[model samples]
Target: MWYNQFRKIQKAGDLMGMTVNKELPLPADLKSEEPLTADIIALKQKRDREIRDIFTGASDKFAVIVGPCSADNEDSVCEYVSRLAKLNDSVSDRLVLIPRIYTNKPRTTGAGYKGMLHQPEPDKAPDLLAGIIAIRRMHIRAIKESGLTAADEMLYPENRSYLDDILSYEAIGARSVENQQHRLTASGMDIPAGMKNPTSGDFSVMLNSVTAAQSSHNFIYRGQDVTTDGNPLAHVILRGGVDKYGTCIPNYHYEDLMRLLAQYQKRELNNPAAVIDTNHSNSDKQFKEQLRIVSEVLHSRAYNSELKKLIKGVMIESYIEEGCQPIGSNRVYGKSITDPCLGWEDTRRLILKIAEEA
Candidate 1:
């Protein structure tokens, strides 16, 4: 291996002095194309209103965001969304259901699907173009069939045009919230947005993101000069942090959130509310703990007046079935294959419990 490495190094020097590698042809200029339609806008507006009503206390409904940790299979994804849509109507009055259509998955070590964007290969086929096509097709079909609005974590700004028409809500993940490009994208985004805090769970970073996303800003959008309306609905999501951990077993630490809410009100921010991500640090990335955290939050609302108004929604990483399997494996149907998740039975019971309490 050492001898091969030396031989490869010599070849790299020779190649560097040889003909240069030309830029690959750019994909068709789909970036300049507009895809969002009237019907899509109408659905988006309706869902936006529902979210607003929930946060503003004009409605008694609780917001529930549930779906796969990351979307991969088009056929299976559509089927799952369709099922969620039916469930949405059944709980329509009491809950606002938002189907999570995330296509990007950021890894701590930079390995994983990265969504269907970087790897179309479910079975070792490296076709990124095919991956993009498959994901876009799945997103459109889900919107058309599910009659449900979708939410995505906006990662690649250039990829926005692909799903702009289909997405209703966008989230800036913990790692990306502090990024200027993401903040700019959030400002220009037409849909309501949520910004999560830094991985350490600092509210100030989230507050800054909220301010950036909610204020009008000038930025380039698809080779055109553009200004955004600035998504006022942008809010904070407290998934908890190790800093707030009990230094032992996992706990939601309601006091941590109460302090955050007071800070929001003190800053005179919009609505003074926060969405508790029932996954991640709040549950210590243990999927089953999601249910307990959510139940505790919902049930504790009675004594926590501040929480009653501030906790408008809960984000759960769930799918058609429970728990996760290894990526790219031919595993059980409906298993996450990404992050471990609360199984269907437990998820259903938790949702019903939250609804009953709400």
Candidate 2:
């Protein structure tokens, strides 16, 4: 195995209280090995534009970002997306379904599965090198076989370059939205980026993130100085919030939407919009409530023309089977190993309903 001799400052090993592992391949090397074909490249270009149009108000169709909470197994993920591709055709008229192939997840306590970046095989030990390749390969297969590029959370902003070409939409997770690096890095991307409100559910902090992502700036990234053109497609995602007492407080109601719209009007940000997360704090982890949550969001949109334009879409957590399980033996084929999901049957029914109404 080859390793880069990182400089002296890299010796933060002692300061950070962790051992240094071998360096992985550069983003370019990984792309070369698991390259996207010309046809796949063309597919992504077309799909990405459709997503951008939804946020820019140039298209009337809504965007539904759905799929597993964490893509732990490649075969299962591909199978899930293959089904989604077939479902997409039916709802293409009113909804643009962007599958969720989240490869990384944030743990409030900072333990457990860190996602495919730490353990490509959920039941196995951590292997950073293998994890990187696994995630890239899984993403490529999802696009090539399904003809649909998906959404992944930007948990590690520095690692986004590895899958930037393969992802149509990326979210700045609630845990990372307040970080300056995540905001600055988002400003340079061309794809649509959704900055979720922090766990505290503060709209001001969320709005500040949107403003920062929509403005150009200079910052050091990946060992070099750079400037960004600012992503006009950047926007907000209301995933609800958690209070000091750990209670889930949802913000997807009509009143919440109106309150957020008022907040957007107060800012100078471009492409003012929001995507309601049907899972998470919104559903309080009751994966089944995703259906009603989405319905409520659509209902709110229909109730107010002003809000109708502001609410571009929603994010749904779903998979082959419903619910989640602890990491161990005898796991369900399509069940989630991270957060619980809405499952396929419920997901299909909910999606079709969304198309008919949205």
| lDDT (10s digit) by residue, model 1, range 1-358 | 9979966766565555663323222334442343446786687778777777776678768888888888867777788888778777667778888888788888778866587665655556556566666676677778788878888888877676677766777778888989987898788776667888777777888899998988888878666688887776788887765555443223356677667776887785655667778888777777888877887778766678777887778899888788778865666777776788776667677777776787
TM-score of each: 0.85, 0.96
**Model 1 TM-score on a 0 to 1 scale:** 0.85
Model 2 lDDT tens row, 111-190: 99999988998889899899889999999988888999999999998898889889999999999999999999999999
Q: Stretches of candidate 2 above 4 Å error?
A: 1-16
In angstroms, the error of model 2 at 289 is: 1.0
Best candidate, TM-score: 2
Q: Which RMSD values do the candidates have, in order?
A: 6.6, 2.5
Task: Give candidate 1 misplaced runs (Cα > 4 Å).
Answer: 1-41, 242-251
Query: Ten-residue segment with the worst summed lDDT in candidate 1?
Result: 19-28
Worst lDDT run of 10 residues, candidate 2, spans 1-10
Per-candidate local distance difference test = 0.74, 0.92
